[model samples]
Target: MNEQDVYDAIVTRRSTRNYKPTPVEPQKLARIIDAGRYAPSGGNSQTNRFFVVQKQEIIADLIKLVEEAFSKMDVYDGMYRSLRNSILRSKEGGYLFCYNAPVLVVVANKKDYGNNMADCAVAIENMMVEANALDLGSCWINQLRWLNEEPTLLEYMRKLGLPEDERVYGAAIFGYPATEDGKPNRVPLPRTGVDVVYL
Candidate 1:
């Protein structure tokens, strides 16, 4: 790809919440995961593990567990807006954190690592950009990470191969778009709040 293509992918990538049931192509999925693995890691630790979940049964179970966990929580004043929204929707039932995407790439890192979250974040961003380049829709899912320490979730994750010394830091859902054109929305949202000061 050319420079302009890379820039366009970076700018046009958006958080895709709705996705088609069609699974992502294996080649494209491999490339997307490769991009994530190529992301720079702090001190070259390179300990981030990727869990690519594509089984419908497993995904369904995860969604159910997440909803159950959130539903049992009590909303409070000054709570994070997205967390509050999650809790409310979960209580109402049928809250799909991955938006029913066919594939969810869960990024995990050493629980005690100082740069765990940062490393996982960089990987996720790389994967999202790659997904956009491949014409695949992707969304960052945070509910698992938010409940990383919950016993129910931890047990489930362990069954899914999550190591005892590791915790989920981030996740990205991937699949084809459900739009009429079968393409992800590419229109860039205007940014007005990011300030920059040249050193």
Candidate 2:
């Protein structure tokens, strides 16, 4: 892709919350993961691990666990809006945190590493950008990270090869969008905030 194309992808990328049952192709998935792996790490610590979850059974179980974990929590006045939303919806039952996407990529890093979340975030952004370039819909999933320390989740994740010393810092979903055109929504939201200060 050229310079303008890169800018276009970055500017138009939007979080896709709905998806079709059709799975993302293996080759395209690999390329997207590679983009994440190539993300810069602090101090050359490339310890971020990627778990590409495409198995329907596993995804179902994850949704169950995530909903269960959030259902147990009570919303607070100052809690993040998304977190509060999750809690409220979860209590109501059947809260699919991953938006029922066909492919869920769970990014984990060393629990003791100070840069774990930052590294995973950088990597997730890269993967999302790459997904947009590939014409695949993607959304950053955060419920897993919020309940990373929950025993039920940790146990289940361990069964999926998550190391005991590592924890989920971030995650994302990728798949063909369920929209009429089967393409991600590229209509950029109105840019109103994120003001920059010139020093």
Per-structure clash totals for the candidates: 0, 0
Report the C-alpha lDDT of model 1 over 109-146, residue by residue, as the tens digit: 99999999999999999999999999999989999999
Q: Which candidate wins on TM-score?
A: 1
**TM-score list, all predictions:** 0.98, 0.97
Q: RMSD of candidate 1 to the true fold?
A: 0.8
Q: What residue runs in model 1 are displaced by over 4 Å at the alpha carbon?
A: none
Error of 1 at 162 (Å): 1.0
Top model number, lDDT: 2
- Name the lDDT value of residue 83 in candidate 1: 99
Q: Please report, as a residue range, the 10-residue window in candidate 2 with the lowest summed lDDT.
A: 1-10
Residue 155 alpha-carbon offset, candidate 1, angstroms: 0.6
